[model samples]
Target: MNYKDLEFSTYPGFDEYILVKNLVDTPVKYKRGASYETIYNNEFNKWQDFFCQQYQVPAGKDVLLLHCCSWAKPYDFSIIINPIKQIADKYKNVHRVIMSNVGVVPYEFQMNETFCGYDFMNVDNEEKNVQEINHLYAKSLEERLFQYLESHIDRYKQVVLYSRPINMGNAPAVKNACERAGIPLIIEPNIDIYVKYRQKKYKQLDELFIEKECLDSLDKTLQLVGEKVGS
Candidate 1:
């Protein structure tokens, strides 16, 4: 079925309630009352794998990593677009990647029903126990993330997880993968600013990148890419 053909849902908990069953041709059945956050990813059954395969890095483009957000379209969020806009358009030759819980997603595929349709993005509380980091859930995601970075590291001219620099706000999985892969990661945002707004105004993972320093670093990185690409 076409993504455009899926009916719009105004579910109370999500921006849209697009059943994973409807998104793909393969049949899927979730357990009774399975929340998107706690749903077991039936990867071998072709559920999560299909979306993971959608990720791609364009030729000669740098890759920028961002965590998945509540909205179906990640770029629709201002924190994402604001920083992107500050960069040079020529150097803006970038592959915006969303480090989603189920899998990695390319920005171009954000509109794909497989990506934009579902609702499972509460990363800080991802583990079975919020205090425990050794759980299977977090381990699975980190394994996949490391594999993603390892496999795709050579594709882009540069891979950067350029986000708001916070002491702990950024995704450690991405940071560790980049570190393991030796990819350049520009993370030095204003923690004081992030802390100031994080408690009262921020409720989502993506919102943590809403810092001025992030925008400036991204602008410089893109400008440098532009210079390197001779655009």
Candidate 2:
């Protein structure tokens, strides 16, 4: 299948649908080569510099940066995995950090991994770790957010942050930061197919439950109770 041939017009729908449907719509293929690493490293360096400059992070301050633990496999194999180290080394002001990545396990398990510092937020990855990371990402986000809020007001105030290739929902965590502080939240690849799938799936489940519980219950009652009364 030509995965690229999916009806998605690149409008950035949820990635879950895109990935689930990708196999059906197009063949899953990843390009491999040494040059892939070189190109990825270059891009990684550029993004690090961009985040540093964009935030005007002064030298020698603890930075609170959030980055995705996943990216294109090529990039992941090369540079996407080491953003915290990269920024910490590049900028002297980056003394401290708060970060997360998608999980490959359930949320409960992912939470422990996150607190232990595994920061793998690519929840969509077929890997158990990645899914586990994602499963616990939101809860972890809430935990980390509150921790940062509680301990380091000054540090959280000056955090030079970045999150991409992962989705943070439209919840109070994001909204509070936006409203309270002008911490600009940037979401790269604005597509949200996963969210759409979640919504659609919920609706289907609701309908099925109603059919099974209400409709089936009434039918069963009529068959059993009605027959008894008539007899």
Candidate 3:
């Protein structure tokens, strides 16, 4: 199916439909031999340098690293990170770290003070919508997170990771990092229950199937990670 042959309609009042043929006509050019390790190492070095320049930290400070996954909407951030935040709040020495490809947190969520530090890694913007062009995007994201953890594994007293197990590309990376660091990793937290709760409470069923699929994928990812960790 040629995506260039599609037309997208505007709002209710607008009668004209925009032709996206020109936009879709140009194919995305992918980099050659792009792998998770390569991308992660590059990003890790860059971010590590940035962190060193931006913040001055004492040698022995403990960091409670909260690794967040890629989330499109503000509600997803709230739903996923809130429980993790509750857990992090228990420790006084834990320095909260939240990293994202884009530094966008919705005003309604009010998570400005929630994190002690932020790592703005613009990896997603480099990715193209075309699967063939950006097949390594998900893996790159997971590797980047793993790389961040690996870099700081020795610097902190204890490292705790809270991320949804939705991407297959980087699940192995996460498991490897956890094993190397000897840290406890928290994967999927009854997202099915969360989905049902959201459905009943908000009555937003428009994207229900999509949400369920994502949650189901996360659950599978969690299982895979558990198996790998145990092995």
lDDT winner: 1
- Model 3 misplacement above 4 A: 1-48, 52-63, 69-87, 102-135, 166-172, 180-184, 188-231
Q: Candidate 1: lDDT of 25?
A: 53
TM-score of each: 0.61, 0.32, 0.39
Superposed model 1: Cα runs more than 4 Å off: 1-23, 27-40, 43-56, 72-90, 121-129, 132-138, 164-170, 188-208, 211-213, 225-230
Q: At residue 81, what lDDT does model 2 achieve?
A: 35
> Among these predicted structures, which one has the highest TM-score?
1
Ranking by TM-score: 1, 3, 2
Of candidates 2 and 1, the better by TM-score? 1
Quote model 2's TM-score.
Answer: 0.32
Worst 10-residue lDDT window, candidate 2: 102-111
Instruction: Give one digit per residue, the lDDT tens place, for model 1 in 81-164.
Output: 545533533454665565544455555544444444455434445556443422443455556666666666666555556544
* Residue pairs in clash, model 1: 165-189
lDDT of 3 by residue, 96-178 (tens): 45544322121122222222222223346454533432445454444544555555665555544444334433334455656
Model 3, position 144: C-alpha lDDT score: 48
Model 2 C-alpha lDDT per residue in residues 1-231, reported as the tens digit of each score: 233343332214422111122222233223221222322333223322322222222333433433333322211232333333332334333332333322111111111211232212223445645434433545544543543334444443343333322344424343355345544343222234223333444432212212223223323322321222223
